[model samples]
Target: MSGQDTSEVGHGHGHGHGHGHSRSRTVAGLLSRVGHAIRPHSHDTADKTDQALEASSKGMRVLAVSFAALMATALVQSVIVAVSGSIALLGDTLHNFADALTALPLAIAFSLGRRAATRRFTYGYGRAEDLAGIVIVLLIAASAALAGYEAVVRLMHPQDVEALGWVAAAGVIGFLGNEAVARYRIKVGREIGSAALVADGLHARTDGFTSLAVLLGAGGAALGFPIADPIVGLAITAAICFVLRDAAREIYHRLMDAVDPRLVEQAESILSGVPGVKGVGSVRLRWIGHALRAEVDIQVSDRLSLVEAHAVAVAAEHRLIHDLPRLTAATVHADPDGSDGIDHHAVLATHR
Candidate 1:
């Protein structure tokens, strides 16, 4: 029999199995007696484009709302800073403003991600989100440097903080605004599987905590310790640095194409359960933007004709698409059990 090859792309749907299995005995079936264990995961693959578009829309809304909220929070704190001359409040306000502005790059990214794939960019514009994540990290670093610099300068030249009550109120406002934005961003980010959005949310959460530190400075200033304002400023800068570290690390992992190991195991289990599949081979999955694509290899009987093999391959691929979440495309290769006593991989063994 000649070798058969097949490729398919599917969005989540179930199809009747056309090919018959002759006393099927797959490697995966013998490995466990507990039966198939599938976790609860669902995907709206029927309308993939619509799903992607909706995710982008959600991201845009998050950016818009968060930007406006942070801007308003900063505006209120800026007025307090002018009247009270509190360096801690000033640092917190600047961070809030910077945090809000970071949304611009992410908005652009979401817009770019919505564009259809072209020959020059066959993978589409999903990686733009990771680039936006890089921009966010840089902005965070810049905010930290500025906050730290201002604190040192203020420490060298002590000054009394006026309107302590207003400064305290501004801190409360900042915390409330930032915490709300953080929760919303994180919730939507996980839903859409957008790492950049989640990182941005974490950045907002840190800003909220730092805003509360402004209250400590106001309390110290009220107690006759003028240096407390600058000290609090430095503390806020340290917190920003921590955020910078976490955001950078998350972006790095995404850029490196890191995924959960459980996803791979789950994919293998799904493929092995398919009828007519005798053995499972390499199963590879990767993210192209927010969605996932898979490549798999399966062993079939050498006695089967080329058409039967192709049908088996298609069946395996169909099973994969229906089971895996966010899996838009999959390539399944069917390898004969033992063809003419020849080793197909011997040609490439030397290279390895």
Candidate 2:
């Protein structure tokens, strides 16, 4: 029942059921406070960095493929726009082109993300993706503004939308290409946990719908309502604004280091289930680019020696790395219950 003997049992049955008495009490209040104030790095393995690299590669490939597809679609639509002079078709073409160009900033971000952590930038360049997201949001806003302007001008001076059949064909072509790109981007983005890519995919999805709007405009023009073309252009502009709002919100969340609350819940559950952990403390998770990192605190019996306590912490870390999706690194701290009357805070003072 003494400290040393109990510690041996604690370490050996680290996966055993929780100690009933200790289960109800929290043990890491000071540790949690200090840990948050002065975060310590417990794990940053090369394998995690390699995983990040693989994610970046996947992102780059998505961007390259989608960019080519959207560009080709826009080029075809531009040719039709020149012949038909349909304002709706013209607005759709511009948005497709802008969406394609957004890939450039993301490409740069992925490349930067691959670079190793340096003394100057210890967290590495993963935040570059968030910055690229900002670039994308601005581009969407710009496209919306330009499209709106053109639509208003066209409304004031309505022109005959020529070659109605060709304009209608271009709409179908735009929808097909943009929709295909959207599906691929969204699928891969979710797989990799890439908000930027997901946002871009949403942008592409809207582009597809606006392309369909072009078809409606064509129908209106054929019925002698030429104003329908400019009106559809305005509709497309409004869709772009919605996309802009969504994309900007995503980037803002990332910049603020917001993560899904469910991740924190999952981490807590995993730590609580660790055999030696008497209780779980704060579990924090954040996204750096497409990857995830976590910092957690756990309480073990005060009977456990430093080595046994460390073993518990290591077990918690391993569980997190194994169970969490996209989690690249995790830091776990083991706090001791104060039954032994040994002051752990005294140790922190020495380090300070």
Error of 2 at 66 (Å): 0.9
The sequence of per-residue lDDT tens digits that candidate 2 reaches over residues 318-351 is 6777788877666676777656677666968968
User: What are the TM-scores, per candidate, against the unseen true structure?
Assistant: 0.85, 0.84
Where does the lowest 10-residue lDDT sum fall in candidate 2? 1-10
Which number leads on TM-score?
1
Give the TM-score (vs. native) of candidate 1: 0.85
lDDT of each: 0.79, 0.79
Backbone clashes under 3 angstroms, per model: 0, 3
Q: lDDT tens digits, residues 176-211, model 1?
A: 999999999999989987777887898898899999
Misplaced by over 4 Å in model 1 are: 1-46, 339-341, 350-352
